[model samples]
Target: MTADTTGVNATTKGADAIDEAIAKGIDFDGTPIPTAKLELYTKVMALEANRQRSGVSNTMRSRIVRIGAKHIPQAELDQLLTDAGFAPLKEKEIAFFYGGK
Candidate 1:
């Protein structure tokens, strides 16, 4: 008599071997992870900075700048304007005459 050794058993056996390996100490490949988080953050930050520079929401900019003036320091305000390409002005000029100080 000949035995019909179906491949389903072999498939289950292979799976069992894999499961046993995992139950012990075998490491399986996992989901992909970022290799350089700093680089990823830097790239995203640069894109966001460029988007902000393009006057993405100029009216929103005005509102925020308007409110922030009441809270931020004069030096910090001046630097923010400088980064946005506006020339810095004297203290009184910044507070009274300029669009953003």
Candidate 2:
């Protein structure tokens, strides 16, 4: 099993494991987290098989930015994550991917 540099699950267990990680807010390292601290680390692999189906034509970073933005409408990406019962993206995480605000 290979680890995704993006910190997303890259094991060959199955798609369900990947989905579980996403739903539970776990990183590729299988770390149990995402509560008070906000940090966005998307499972890019999940979208690997569906990138064409989703009609996304941007680069990985751009796609991640879009995911952060689309997760919540009219609300800060981190705030939405926090509200969703998962850890929200911190300032650094936001700056790194979503740009500094």
Candidate 3:
């Protein structure tokens, strides 16, 4: 029997609609987006858009360190990276990402 594709299409359409609303600064619940929050987000995203990139792998590693450090302990994240065949966190990265924790 052929698989039904309608569910996937519906999900995609719903996501697209939500994205369109977000771009227009309208919340899904129909409230207008707060000006202060929107302005700050736009400014930060603009800066991120202009940031320099070294390479895909370096960028990936940086993102992993930045986000993973928020949710995982330092040693656990480092071991996970090594086990996944990525380079273990460097001293500088550890200091920067986990210094306060």
Candidate 4:
């Protein structure tokens, strides 16, 4: 997903935003991502994609790291997600989380 800059807080860094989103289960999209999906994300990431650091699993591992970084709200996550397929939530959308959603 792409980071939707339109909704990001000018004062908050992307990594911090992402961190809050993950901790609070705020969907990057305006709509709420069902908890099941969130659980699934946890489960999927737990899978042993590779045994050796030598092949396809390594690629998967890298992708997982990028995904984690995105959630980590790390500065690098934005760059990685720029090349990634999903989009981030908008600023207005994030308000719902604080609004008692």
Highest TM-score against the true fold, candidate: 3
**Residue clash pairs of candidate 1:** none
Lowest lDDT 10-mer window, candidate 2? 54-63
| Candidate 1 lDDT by residue in tens digits, 1-100 | 4333333234434446544433333223322224465457557867976774545455545544656577777678668767876655356645663446
lDDT of 4 by residue, 35-95 (tens): 8988887676567543345666556645555456435544344445446643443344334
- Positional deviation of residue 47's Cα in model 3 after best superposition, in angstroms: 3.4
On lDDT, who's better, 2 or 3? 3
Backbone clash pairs for candidate 4 read 1-85, 1-86, 1-87, 2-86, 2-87, 2-88, 7-90, 7-91, 15-73
In candidate 4, which residue ranges exceed 4 Å CA deviation? 1-20, 29-31, 48-51, 55-101
Estimated TM-score per prediction?
0.27, 0.27, 0.56, 0.31
Question: What's the lDDT for all of these models?
Answer: 0.52, 0.53, 0.76, 0.52
Cα lDDT of candidate 1 equals 0.52
Question: All predictions: root-mean-square deviation over Cα?
Answer: 21.6, 15.1, 8.8, 16.0
Which one is best on lDDT? 3
lDDT of 4: 0.52
Model 1 stretches with alpha carbons more than 4 Å out: 1-57, 84-93, 97-101
